[model samples]
Target: MHILVTNDDGPPSNQSSPYVHSFVRSLQAAGHTVSVVLPHIQRSWIGKAHIIGKTLIPSYFRPGTLHKDDGVASHHPFEDGKEEWVLIDGTPASCVQIGLWHLFQDRGPVDVVVSGPNYGRNTTALFSLSSGTIGGALEAAVCGKKAIALSYAFESREHDPEIIAAASQVSQKLIEKLTQDWPEDVHLYSINVPLRNNVAEAKILYTNVLQNRWTTGSSFEEAEVEEEVDPAEQEKEIREGERNGTNGADESSVARRKQKRFKWAPKFTDVHESVRAAGPGNDGWAVKEGIVSVTPLKANFCHVPNIKGEIKLSSKTSISGDQILASSSMPKLYAIIDYPDPYVQPLILSAIRSELKDLDVELISSVQQLPSPASPLLQYRDYESVDFEHALDQPRSSLLCAYVVRKALIRKHYLSNTISTWLVKHPQSPLKTHFKAAVNFELDYAEFLDEALVDAWDLNDSMTRNEARGNDNGNKEWWILKPGMGDGGNGIRLFSSMEQLQSIFEEWERDEENSGGEQEEEKEEKEKVHSPSSGNKVPTSASYGGTMTSQLRHFIAQPYIDPPLLLPSRENRKFHVRVYCLAVGALKVYVYKEMLALFAAKAYQLPSHLEVDLSCHLTNTCLQDGPSREGSVARYWDLEDTAHGPDWKEKVFEQICEATAAVFEAAAREQMVHFQTLPNAFEVFGIDFLVDSFLRAWLLEINAYPDFKQTGQQLQDPLIGGLFRQVMKVAVRPFFDKEAEDNDSQGSSEMRLVRDIDMGRR
Candidate 1:
């Protein structure tokens, strides 16, 4: 392997610095080519920093030269050797940068950059925070190279050649092992070897940097110096003396005899105590036990949550944004696409691949082989886990979806209807104009109310029984019954009388007691009744009536709109508008403008009795049995173009957006626990709205994890694909790409922002 070596402790010497030369030789002996670059002077305790604006001149140092007074001869006093090391008049981090990119062009690319074999041990956070040895390695990591920071711990400040040789060999072995089998997502490693005669035989342990802070006192003290020394004053004096052909030493001595000074006199008692109290897995404790400590690290700051998981802090995988941008190979990002919907799965996967195409990110689809801390693009149905949760839940899979939508929209109709009622009660609520009147009750309880009592109950904002009876044409009121926590048009019934409503529940109980084979026949029998030509046989029971024992308890009953707006171009079929909305991060709501109009299978007709066919009353395409209903789904924009007035659809769309914002706001305000707005989570909802002949849109209901497959192949590309792509840009990209922070794309042009409630104060 090709290696570049650097250190905070400059070139090797008998004192101040040693071991670097021996370590380099050891690596060469192990059949690895090595190049060296280092600071011209000691640069300890300075973190990862470049000296901004300075001219760094390179000087050569010969190995094994003897030290002389007068700051060692200008020609140097170090080792005498054929090999030459490059010395930089800058900090350790600067050397790594210059060494990797500018130097070693003829030697080919440097595979790994090794920093240190530092003079003192860098074990805990206290020392590591300000260590230039680790800083050099950090710089190399940010530049997209494998790096290791090596330090030698000594019992005392004395030289031991035998111990140094043993330590060097140990470090070489560890370095080779790590280079061959480095752990995933680890940016760099910090290794500390105890300098002892038997160091080569010591056990190497994986450890964590001890999280410690200085607690006793300040690490500086006032020293009684002869005078104050100013760097600018000294520099000027040196230049003036140089022109006169004399050194500035005598002139500087005279100026320094003026005032007192302060020196760094650190109080290490607290550090020592903390080390002693540390656990065995800590880097400091491992070194104290005469073992080598290797702490793998990421290039980002450590984030501490109020609660921790089963995994240790050291074991979690992390990657820095710098590494992501600088890396040559594609970054591997794993996504779990576990949804079984045929129409939605392939389209979403394709969209994700397309959105991240420019970044050269590899998408991993196998859930079983994922690396720790996988990407946040999980598109699964009703799946959530703490393992996949992020600061912002995006790409759908691990999203805590029930928090803001599913519970408020589908779980209990009573809760949703009550929330809608609360929204209308506010004088300024848009729902007052767009929301439909509805009531919720348990199916068992509703079975007990008589026809007279049902009519006496407050159903429509205290409208008189005669007024609630019908419209000006005197048609009796019709109601649609929906099972609480039910979806996909299951156990839904349309009724015009209390007798018909009570009989629907009775049919469900009979279906539940029948055999599985008998239930199938009964289901087919029910489907046959949906056709208008099939006489007055009520198709009151769905297949769900037999299996919905748990969810059959609660139900919502809403007075059905009699004359739903029918388009002449649409063959006068009854249809409902399906709009997609997104809720992000503590209450920011947006509506996707490209909506879908789902048409019922048959032509529209006002219902007057229990003999009503759901094919005429329900617009869900899922209920339509045959492939003959190819035109069931159409773009809302196309419908808008065909409307009588050019602005009619646009005006209705405004009402839809307004009503959507109002419903979400009321849900979050009233049912905070069930509809929590988490900063790290977002969800897409399918909201259905009904339109009257007057072109007024009314909020009907909300559906969480809406059926994207219902959009069908014809509209999936522009509707579903665009939605997933925009979601990736708005939600997932910012975590891995920094450029996404400045350009949000405003969640793309299709999504319209309606409500924003900042939860930042919490």
Candidate 2:
């Protein structure tokens, strides 16, 4: 996909803004075609002002070619298809305008726009007025395209080099995830990454803007001096000579030309009253507390008045008493006994009970026994139910359950199967048939394996791991490997030699043999064997082969990614992304709101190959090794260091929405098929992504059912509650209508029978 990359930092020629280069490079790495446009000179804080009545001309900036000491060329200019740099002698906002109007015109409309790694925080009231970074993003938003403004705030400028480098890294990760998974509604995002060595340890706070103003100290000072002749008279004489257009050797000219100097001293006054208090839980608080704040600011801030009018209640509104009676008599919804897995069953039951309270619900083993659950309100013994017998007779009962649900929902008109049929017919709705089929949920790994091969062939190594994971302690050679499927670094083991692998395997075998027994008995035996306090317990090196070895079934070997550098003054840091997504066209709004912004201490170190092998960038709270690990699992808002102070929750949501939008747009362009399905039929999805030190976003996994428990609790406010209620209202209304209609039809028949019996008795 074609992307326009610009920043307030200007071009690469400017040493002050080095992140622009890295940002462009990361986009290219993600298979996006990139074009860079930036200012020739620094124009910091130039908010959204544009040059009027002046044509913007592109110019070349030669900061001089960078080269090695041996005279080897380290950089060269692009001659034809690509340019090393294009500089415009205008504001950052002007640069974005030129790119959109001219540079991207021939290539078709730009998909997404990214702005900055601005030097400081842009929060609270300053956000709307932030001309430097937000200006470009606002320009993009105005153009009806999604945009993001990235920034970094640090305690001191001394550590800028390290901070800039880290910003670039994390920025890349953010861009990747944003371009691939963000939703369509979000127009723009403002992201602020706090500058600290322990970036991985940095907490991501979704925050609101802090409207606090900085206090300015008075430059006045107390002084006693003899009064001098009025300087105003001298200035008037000089102005009179200039107006007369005379270098006349007259008295006035002479007086005007005379050198006049006075001591310019002012007494220093006390600093202006501190304007620190803006509002509660603002971005300033988060930044002060050492957290990365992400804020989503809406383009429009108008509050339209609600005109009062006559309240016209809908005709369909049923009488409260009648509706209550009907609701009470409604059929009890029973839980389908599909999966034997105890884990999922309870969750399903909980959801059902919560939604269908007062309705009878029972667990039935099979279709034939479905009618055995005695309830006056509900009954079932139909052919469709009998079809379950054939369905469950399959290899995977879960798939069978999905199929049955799909069939039932379709039959009852709860969902449209027509779209599924259309998809089958067209096969190439948005992307090529193969790519479309590959993304369809029903098509399993086996079906998509061939398509995966084709995708791999087309993309080459782009789809593979970008870099070998770096090891901690600055050692590049020795590394700790990790399995892809293992959670919490469970299957990870050091592999300095083949002997270690063999020994580990042997130990695993011994443990397996010792624990083997009947299913239940074996489970108990294995649990005892792996217990932490077991007597004569195996050492770390020896325990590697036990359950850990088995956990390596689906894994990837990698050199451990390094932990972030630690600075003494800052809070311990860690970062993770909770991406929410919905199907492209599915109905029933699946809003995956809220996220867990987790963090861990700098001292809470993971082992390395040399020292027990846990040093890595895997920031999952479940993976952290420390006594305080349990507290790492926090709601995004709670992750803020209250002592230091910013409430970053709102800002984080805004950033997520903005980044997610950019990602969805980019993904649509790159993977056209999935894009076509978006913002329509689907509701929402949560994508777990990780940002590396370089700011490059890496896709961790796509969760169909992103846990909403934490989110529901975090955003327990009325606004969120209203949104939830709105969506639920839309989703279940049809089912409720169907129930009402059936009740009406049944009631009419019973009354007719009653009348007939009365006539017969007379």
Candidate 3:
């Protein structure tokens, strides 16, 4: 195997340590072609830094000759005429980076990269990440190669011959196992072993890096004792130095006595008993107890809440941003095409056409589409763990691609409505009632009578009858029932009486039972009646995007916006305007200039009876865009299709755009904070709005995943295709840039694709 061996402790000749030369010699004896590259000088705790402004020249330098004062006589002290030494005047990370790409470019891909026999132990979360020894190995892993960060733990800061032999022997055996068959899930292994004389057997322990946030303590101190020297010789030496005018070394004066001396240095804490109590195992504790510690690592970081099955943690300790950025110089980008939707096809093509052309968009059609399963709906909360520097480093099985795919979630509605309410509620927000069109309270079961809109008690003569019976109004009322999370108007019921609502409530009880949520009394209730089918026989009960079972636990009820302005062509047919809101990141929200106009199938009126029928209300395209009465489906209209003409369209559109813009700002403030990590996600919201007769647009609900297909004859726009083309430039490519990121500040946009909807971020 072509093995590349490197370390932070320069080389065997310059370093006082014997581990680097000894390990390389052992690998050569084991019948492997070992190549050597290391920092020109000792770069112990340099972390993962690379020269930013200057290019690195991987110059071949005679090892010990570079630092003559280290007392080594020859550069090739351990040379048996089988090894080559290459040096780069940079961090250990840069050594591995240049070694793989430049020095060994012609020798084919490296089989494995082994970094360090680092002079000191690299244990615990903070030190392991900060150690340059591990940084070099991590760089190799970032380059899609298996790597091990090896360290030697000694009782004192001394590398004895006995300790050197033990470290080399143990490390070579582990290297062989890694080359033959590595751990399936981990790409990088940080192996820290105890360096001791061979007196007994020492067991290898699997451990997790202990966690702690250490605040480095520092101060300067003065020496209290007086210096003693040869009196006559010191006087003569001082006189000679005074004659030469070089008395910088004199320490007898009061000013010299006051000179500052370092009392303490910055350091990270070890894996102690307190840390051991908190984990499956602790890496520092293993080394402290004379056992070799091996920790497994993975690439994924974000939380997967809506995964189809069990939620599994990818690793014990997630690799932080600095650790990922410290290693690997290559920058690449790949997208996971998790869906085969027609709208998604354009995006893959556009990403290929842009800077992401180097990447082949991975088309995911099944669970096996990727090397591992992907839950596209995962919230990008652990953004801090995603190393943008190594984002293109293809993870073995789990990966979060450039463009994220998410399902319409119930929390979307609550966030959108809650933010709008919150903004309107705050005096400092400067946002007015334009944001007050959604649910007025926090969503918890969306129960009735608690801030209930219109009570179904009005269905009966209950109020009038109670007044006649000399009774005061004190009873709770029913509300317009809608599923917590819904799309295309699947499970919607406008109940006129309390009995119809009671029946729907009983069915919710059954749904909770199936979901394993807290279930209520086992009350049998028939499926609520929906729109009339083509044959107009039994009412269809098919669920649309989400199953009926998932919707029962989460739902929201608002005052049914009644008596909406009608499309005069179909007299009293209530219609609502649907707009699109696109957010590439948190605090970056934009509203598409154009929108769709969808209307209900039947004429609008109050259902005075207890029997429920969805045909009259709920203007969802899936329900209303089917077969029409006059052999024509009616949905999605232009100004020419409506009787109000372009003037009315102009009047209502201003309010629609204004309300949507307000919702975007309010939602950003309320919802985006939860999603701190921005690189893993980009979303376009399907925002629905109702235009009241007052010409004001009321915020309805926000759909997390907007279905981009043409439902009816709305004629999907060509401009919508421009959206995907811009996403590569605006969102994905920026993560790859080496410069610092300020994506949240809202840069200028090409008006063709998206408009500036920045509402002055406070």
Worst 10 residues of 3 by lDDT: 316-325
Off by over 4 Å in 3: 1-332, 347-413, 427-479, 496-499, 507-551, 570-572, 610-612, 624-626, 629-637, 641-645, 671-680, 712-719, 733-762
Per-model C-alpha RMSD? 26.5, 26.0, 27.5
Clash totals, every prediction: 9, 73, 2
User: Candidate 2's residue-wise lDDT over 386-424, tens digit each?
Assistant: 344343342221112122222211111111122234345
Order of quality (TM-score) = 1, 3, 2
**lDDT at 365, model 3:** 30
What does candidate 1's lDDT look like per residue over 516-608, in tens digits? Answer: 786576664454334322332237543334444434567777777768889878888888999998886676788898999999888887764
Better of 1 and 3 by lDDT: 1
Q: After superposing candidate 1 on the true structure, give the runs of residues whose Cα lies further than 4 Å from its correct spot.
A: 1-333, 358-360, 364-405, 412-415, 445-456, 460-473, 513-551, 640-644
Please name the candidate that would achieve the greatest TM-score relative to the true structure. 1
Alpha-carbon shift of residue 590 in model 1 (angstroms): 1.5
User: Over the stretch 133-167, how does candidate 3's per-residue lDDT look in tens digits?
Assistant: 88888788888888888987755434466666656
TM agreement with the true structure for every prediction: 0.51, 0.32, 0.40
Instruction: Give the C-alpha lDDT of model 3.
Output: 0.51
